[model samples]
Target: METRPLDVLNRGRDKRIVIILKNEKEITGKLQAFDIHLNMWLSDAEVSDSEVTKKYGKLLVRGDNIVCASPE
Candidate 1:
């Protein structure tokens, strides 16, 4: 069977995932929601980098700013 990216993303809902942004920032969280445009909402989000780590109860990421997403 052939599956599209969205199909994979849909399957990832409510699961832990890592989102990579255009700026090379990485955010890890539970997938809450997503749209055809790739706009996404993540719950219990966290950004971990060389400098520091930030946390959020919820996060909305614009589609244009997203580089890629994968299961955590």
Candidate 2:
């Protein structure tokens, strides 16, 4: 059997996942939607970096800004 990156992501839908950004920021939330480009929409999002953590009711992240995204 084989698995693909998007497959993993699909399974993570509506689940908590961690997204790493190019700026080394981390965002964790329940994934709401995603596209082929990796653009994503998240709910109950928390963005964190070295200094602080911020919360968002909803978030849209560009595919270009993402380094990696994995199930948390």
Candidate 3:
């Protein structure tokens, strides 16, 4: 049997995931929620922009801005 993309993603729920944004920023966080559109909610997120890294307790990412995402 073949696994679908969402099935893989669903298995990653509540786990650490890294997301690359369109602007080239990278974010690593614990996956909280997601939808069919690929919109996501993350907890304890750390965003890395070049040499700068920032932290957020929670973050909401729009699907349109996501370049790639995978479990860490």
Candidate 4:
């Protein structure tokens, strides 16, 4: 059987993903949801101890803003 690249990445709910934001910041969080447009919602982010906490409930990351995403 041939495996697709997305298949490897698409581990589904609660999967950990490392997102690199456009502001040059990196966040590692659980995959919360995904829209039809492929927009991702990440929650319970594991950030640095010294990092300032975000005011938002969930991080709203644009697809284009993502530098790279990998399993954590």
In what order do the candidates fall by TM-score, top score first? 2, 3, 1, 4
Global CA lDDT computed for model 2: 0.92
For candidate 1, list the clashing residue pairs, or say none.
none
- The CA-based lDDT of model 4 is what? 0.65
lDDT by residue (1-72, candidate 3, tens digit) is: 446776778888999999999999999999999998899999999999989999999999898899989885
Write down the lDDT of every candidate, Cα atoms only. 0.87, 0.92, 0.91, 0.65
Task: Return whichever of 2 and 3 wins on lDDT.
Answer: 2
Per lDDT, what order, best first? 2, 3, 1, 4
TM-scores of all predicted structures: 0.89, 0.91, 0.91, 0.62
The candidate with the higher lDDT, 2 or 4, is: 2
* Worst ten in a row by lDDT for model 1: 1-10
> Model 1: runs farther than 4 Å from truth?
none
lDDT of 1 by residue, 1-72 (tens): 536768788788999999888888898999999999988899999987778989999999888888888975
Task: Name the candidate, 3 or 4, with the larger lDDT value.
Answer: 3
**RMSD of candidate 2 to true structure, Å:** 1.2
Candidate 4 accuracy as TM-score: 0.62
Rate residue 49 of model 4 by lDDT.
Answer: 31
Across 1-72, the per-residue lDDT of candidate 2 in tens digits comes to: 447768778788899999999999999999999998999999999999999999999999998999898985
Query: Per-residue lDDT for 1-72 in model 4, tens only?
Result: 437544545666678787666677777778887654446787876543346644344765667666667765
- Which prediction has the highest lDDT against the true structure? 2
Model 3: what TM-score? 0.91
